[model samples]
Target: MWTGNFWKQAAERAVKTFAQASLALLTGDGMGVLDVNWGDVASVGALAAIASLLTSIVTSTVGEPNDPSAVRRTNP
Candidate 1:
């Protein structure tokens, strides 16, 4: 997790999670896009981002040392 690549992957995951969470909230049951509670969306997004970061940390040791999303270490 100390490598720059790992951090970049973590950041990307967090941003994607935040965007998805915001969209889910905006489209929730009986709610129009304009009816979104911005504060709630932000809170959920932040929590999702933090979870993504923690997942990245926990999985980092199992993959490529420098790449958080890698499924296996390369033999280069």
Candidate 2:
């Protein structure tokens, strides 16, 4: 049930959330290591998952998906 806007919104929301979280950490003047669970960093988790999933999907669907899509031109 995802339109193109779904991906767009999700990306924007993630960026904003991450920015806010970063600001919070920086402003706290060394919140310091308290051994936290860090569930709020879902943006990072989502990014990692997306990267891995896309890598697998592309690699499986097409050979060498990470490679450049180009046609070699031979000099005459």
Candidate 3:
């Protein structure tokens, strides 16, 4: 289950990840911006990595706040 905070964190992480990875092209390609090749598989992989990080963060965060898992854990 996902809390509102989880989505919020994921959104922020994805944006930051995209920006950082895209900026990396500037240094590597001397393009001063995201290079065209960045639109390739590596970019998609980076996005997936970002999503994974979000999921992990949210999973670890579970059972902390009002942790939506509380109800399920008690019932099961």
Candidate 4:
């Protein structure tokens, strides 16, 4: 079952990754750091969101088998 927790976890991961990436870039640039483009950040966020959406959709649609027989039928 695709619950609220699943979505929340995905979103949290995306945000955390984005923040870490941005921070790394900023620190790497040193004192002469150039402006961080808003568009670039948006793109990264968008990609992460898309990935999470796709994963949720796929898992929700193709759920686990209900019984042991069902699993065996598919596997064997």
lDDT of each: 0.84, 0.46, 0.56, 0.54
Report the backbone clash tally of model 3: 0
Which model scores highest in lDDT?
Answer: 1
Error of 2 at 47 (Å): 9.0
Runs of candidate 4 with Cα error greater than 4 angstroms are 31-34, 41-76
The CA lDDT at 43 in model 2 is: 53
lDDT of 1 by residue, 1-76 (tens): 8878789889999999999987788776468767767899999999999998888899888877776674985578
User: What is the per-residue lDDT of model 3 for residues 1-76, given as tens digits with 9 covering 90 to 100?
Assistant: 3577755655666666666665665455665333356555367648765765656565644655533222235554
User: What does candidate 2's lDDT look like per residue over 1-76, in tens digits?
Assistant: 1345434544554555566665565455455545433564455555654654444434432432232212234579
Ranking by lDDT: 1, 3, 4, 2
Ranking, TM-score, top scorer first: 1, 3, 4, 2
Candidate 4's residue-wise lDDT over 23-67, tens digit each? Answer: 665566563335766677567656665665566555543444321
Residue 46 alpha-carbon offset, candidate 1, angstroms: 0.6
For each candidate in turn, the TM-score is 0.84, 0.38, 0.49, 0.47
Residue-level error in angstroms, candidate 4, position 4: 0.8
Model 4 residue 55 distance off true place after TM-score fit, in angstroms = 8.1
